[model samples]
Target: MKLFPYKPRRYQEEIVQTIFDCLKDRKHLIMEAPAGSGKTICALVACLSFVSENDKGIIYLTRTNSQQKQAIQELKRIAEKLDLKAVSIQGRTNTCLLIDAIPSLKEKNMSNEDVARLCAARKKRSLEAMRGKEEWNRCIFFENFLLIKNELKFDRVVAAEELVEYGRKYKICAYEMNKMLAKKADIIIAPYIYIFDEFLREKFSMLYS
Candidate 1:
């Protein structure tokens, strides 16, 4: 699929082929490549190729935002060679505008669960207030999200920066948009905690499975 700009090294090509073979055989692969080995690009190209061939999706679990950015960048490069849709998601704490705007939550050093609870409480209040109103005054971002969700597209790679910019431009919650996008994204990039943390793992499994 002309996955890379330059010719791949023998080892990189081997890794790519091995990944494809493992996927085809329905086997698991554990690979460790040292820094400067272009492991990121190799994995992206190989797995993306597999996904396109099989009409499946890839959930890329990374450790940090920097790693997510790296993966997204490589995916962007690969998108030039193939039609791909990808999205990078961070924890709600990093992407939630409502929680960020609440001083009390910040002062209390609220946990993620706490922040979620408080945010839900606020949203509930807004929803109740708008029960009889002609206009909506809830979280505008979330409101806009619901309004435009049916028209949302997921046919191109969407990095965190672009995701945030889109939400800001449309007044939609970036965090919510990411969740919705994940359902249709060919590649879903997220922190390891999303798949490792007990509570979140179960929740996301239910949502995506």
Candidate 2:
């Protein structure tokens, strides 16, 4: 099967085949390739092939948003050639509508955890207010999120920027939308910290684990 858009050089083909073999044999692999060697696409196509055959999914971990976006772009190209779907998820600070809406949080030198805590507090207050009223006074985006959560499609590659746009256009929380989509995505691209950061890891354990 043709996995890449362009012709794979000899070394790239070798790496892809090796990855396929290792996955098929259920063996661990440690490969080292130089920069700009097409390692991203090679690994992507190889793992996608393995998942297609096994009826499983792929979780790709990177270190930054740029890396995640790069992978998503490559996945999008591959999707043009194959029927594949992928999603790129960043931390709450990057995708959270609540935090983004709060001007204080944007200007203050707050960590992601701190921003998350403040956002959670705001949400809690909004939920409490709902006990007396019929309408939601909390984050409108989050309330609207529940309405369209089930209708989201994961049948195609969605980059972080595109996901945020959908959320904004639909009046939902982008971060929450990503979490919902992650469950159904054929491939999930996230930061490496999601696996090691205690709080973040616990939050995504259900989807990733």
Candidate 3:
């Protein structure tokens, strides 16, 4: 496939074929390979091949935030050869700017749900303020977002950290930006909690499913 991006390493073609076959047959696959065996790229090529023709999406789950980097790098290479848009998603606890800026929110050690609730309220107020209701406090980061949202693009593979830094520079909420990007992503790279947690998984599924 054009998405492979490089000549196959030893057994790499076999790995790709096995995965493609499993996906085509609607069966489960378990692949065990040594480190540096091109497994990551193999899986990307195989899945992209299927999804490109089938009009589907891919959700690549990693154990930790760090593990997402390698998969994103490999996916970037494949994207150069094929048309694709991808996003690395992270939770609000890592990407919310208000929590860091407000002492009370930061000192309380809020859970993810708490952070989500606060963010939702702030966003609601931001919208309400935009619609001429000036009674509620607005999230400044989201205010900045309204200024820059039209200029934003996610045509390439965007790692979560890189997006976060971009949001920092623009003074927008990275987590909210991620949600907007997720709506258009062909492949989504996220941590396991996105699948293991029922609430988050439902939200994630609604984005790309």
TM-score per candidate: 0.86, 0.86, 0.93
Task: Name the TM-score of candidate 1.
Answer: 0.86
lDDT of 2 by residue, 83-158 (tens): 8768898767777776567687678867877867866876776666656654343677776776667776654888
What are the clashing pairs of model 2? none
Compose the digit string of candidate 1's lDDT tens values, residues 29-86.
9988788898888878888878788888899988878888999888887888887778
lDDT of each: 0.77, 0.80, 0.86
Best by lDDT: 3
Question: Which regions in candidate 2 have their CA more than 4 angstroms from the true location?
Answer: 127-137, 151-155, 207-209
RMSD (Cα, Å) for all candidates, in order, is 2.7, 2.5, 1.6
Residue 75 C-alpha lDDT in model 3? 83
True-structure RMSD for candidate 2: 2.5
lDDT of 3 by residue, 1-209 (tens): 56788888789888999999999999999889898898889988999999998999998999977679989988889888988989888888989888878898899999988988888889899988888888466698987888788888765888888878888887887887887887788999999988999988898788656
Q: What's each prediction's clash count?
A: 0, 0, 0
Q: How close is candidate 2 to the true structure, as a TM-score?
A: 0.86
> What lDDT would candidate 1 get against the real structure?
0.77
